[model samples]
Target chain A: MNKHPHIRIDRYALVRNTVFVWLTAVVVAGFLVNIPRINILEHTARNLYFHVPMWFTMMAAVGVSGYHSLRLLQTGSLIRDIRAMQAARVGAWFGVLGLLTGIIWSKFTWYVGTDVWWNFDPRQTMASLQLLIYGAYFVLRSALDDPDRRARIAAVYNLFAATTTPFLLYVIPRQLQSLHPGAEGNPAFSDITEPVMRLIFYPAIIGFIGLFWVLYTQRVRTAWIKYRVIRDPEL
Target chain B: MEQEVQSIQDSLRAKESISTPFDSIWTGADVPTVDPSALEQVMLSNDKLYVVLAVVLLIWFGFIFFVYRTDRRLSQVERTLEDRIYERDDEV
Candidate 1:
């Protein structure tokens, strides 16, 4: 019963409720707020609130996972291992949603009349590759049977995966030609994004990241319970 | 077919007039154009707002799927606990 000493249930509940309300507001504002429509983007510009936040949330999740993995390496705490794995698991889900949403958004806007759903846009390609790297981290975990060995090995692999995330998601994509904004010689988001969109966009990012935290924490709590009862911390 | 091509060309011409660096790459003559399939037609309507709807729906479904996964884990834990309790009772 006393296994989850780290989790402050009351604090978690407060943040969870706040996020629930905050994201509701963000979604409402996202749709209701008006922006001057550009040619192809038109109303899909509203995706700025939804699709873009997913990547930001995934990045935040990666940061959390990486930090915990580092701590696990330093202190050899199974709790840190649990946190890292759950953060990665939740983060990868966000990445999946981000990629799928990007596909749908691009299909209509960029592909338009063409049947090309995937044209290997540099950012999209890099993003998928980044997800695969994280996928390997999970696969690597399942391969190892011993908990201590798995945690240490997975932590090392997680660190490597974390290192690749930024380059694949932001740096390499920017270096290449892509339809995504902030790509080589194209308008960066600051130049193209309207001030009105920023009102909702920034908050949406915060809300989605908060949502990630809640989900990640819930998983960690469950893992801790499992660890106490079954003496197996891997979840 | 000719009219569709004409309209696409006209739109390209219009885009060329105000093309940004990103726009020029996608709108270039090298890029092929096609008639919208019935599916594309449905998705591309209303300024492609349906794309936003679709993206939102995808995220919603993703969250639902995650919840189910967590639930499955919880169920496994519950089953294990029940089995352990029965084992202890049998020992008594």
Candidate 2:
């Protein structure tokens, strides 16, 4: 009835359209723009534009989710709780996509002529572990029935989950031996990655993160509407 | 199709002759090597470009699925709103 004071639908529409066009351009450039092919990587080096962005988007989602969870703790606002929950849900989906795409990329590129689909590469394993941590966050939310109690407890758990994400996705993976580019003793993006690839890669990251914002915000809006009508925000 | 497959195989063989930094990492003594299966053969073709295609498609599908789920939530909220309106009309 109050026109949903917190959300500006017009602004959301503008962002949604921008993300749609931006990502379409990214996908086109991602394939059309050529780079110097390497021995194992070859054209699959283009995966830097697609596969890597999933992780970056997931990281951004985690940051958004964590910030909202922190606010939920401080403000005791149900809207913040809804936002934090939706962010984590969407973020986890991105992580799952990242993991699956990584598996596919490695299957053809790294594990070619081999029977391996999953060899437990350090980064791959740690990424899956990070997803499981977010998985626990969802399960924890479902366990609590009272909205306020659920919000408080889930926010605390989400913060803990967010804290582990950096370590699991970046720190631990870099510390261990990994086929992933940024591992210890490996030539990272700065050294081996081509400038042409970076041209598409960075934009791909921004576009995917923007896309995440669109999806997450849409879910939050729907959940907020449910809260206004039914007094429950879980969707 | 056969010629295309042959060209891909020739290119793959040619690539094996030249050593790069990745070769050292991927072909380490500890690494196990085996024959590629049919699925691997298809994916490994065209400089493994199909792998990039697969990755992109997977992400696209993932987003589509998420969108569908959000639409479902919207429908549920709309139904609830409709029910509430009907209840108020009855009260009136």
Candidate 3:
């Protein structure tokens, strides 16, 4: 246990508790803080604080996962493999949440009259595609029976998946026409979006990313314990 | 019908005062743009408060799922420890 510092339960409890309090404050501030209403956006404009943070969190998660995957390839440390997998898993969940939130936001604000839930918007489509790439990374892991081989192969695939995430979520989506802000000459957060909104929005991103860290750390700790017991760290 | 007439008059006045094409086109259309179902009507009202409810509920369910998964993993870890303890007792 002393040799494996990653598995040791150190100040994780303190950080986890702090994250819980921080996110609670963010949610409260998110709803209570007044935002200048746009005609179509109305109250749904508030979603910018929540929905946008999810992608930021996902990107942060991807960074963590990819970093660990890189370390795993370099050192072949089992803990690095576990960290990579858990981060990707948690990141994918955040992506799902982001996609669902986006659908609900767009349905009312953009598709109010059409009764459409999914309109194949560029950003939405690319986000789904990005998730699929990560999905393949998971499937690739399950296919391998040997732990060492699985880690090596999955790490490579995870790196690939992470590389493509930014393009799929940000670059390509921006290249095409999208209802999402900052798409096709539409400024992302121009003066049109009130500056006051940033008070809640910036912290919301940090809070959600903090939330991601807490969840990812929990899963990594569990996986590390399981690895010690079973000597196979595939999960 | 009155609301529709009022919408038309509002759009006409709005068009004269402001030429925001999107708003005017939506309001100026001869046919009503939407026939929301009862569920949609309920959800769409009050500035779509129910949409917020739905988003919060979705997040709630997602957290619930994470809780369940964590609980299951804890049980598995507990079972492993229990098995090891039983084996130690037998050895003694």
lDDT of 2 by residue, B1-92 (tens): 65765665565555565568755223323322444567877787555666876797678767756765665667576667767767777887
Clash pairs (backbone) in predicted model 2: none
RMSD of each: 10.2, 9.2, 9.1
Error of 3 at A29 (Å): 0.9
Q: Show model 1 residue runs off by greater than 4 Å.
A: A1-3, A232-235, B1-92
* lDDT (Cα, tens digit) per residue for candidate 3, span A88-201: 999999999999999999999879899699989999999999999989898999999888989999999999999999999989988998888878866787656787788888
Task: Judging by TM-score against the true structure, name the best candidate.
Answer: 2
TM-scores for all candidates: the values are: 0.74, 0.76, 0.74
DockQ of 3: 0.06
TM-score of model number 3: 0.74
Better of 1 and 3 by DockQ: 1
Question: Can you give the lDDT of residue A162 in candidate 1?
Answer: 96
* TM of chain B vs. native, candidate 3: 0.63
Model 2's CAPRI class is incorrect
lDDT-wise, the better of 2 and 3 is 2
Better candidate by lDDT, 1 or 2: 1
Off by over 4 Å in 2: A232-235, B1-92
Estimate, for each residue in B1-92, the C-alpha lDDT of model 3 and write its tens digit: 55744655554556654546555344444544455456755564445566776686578557846755774676577567657656776887
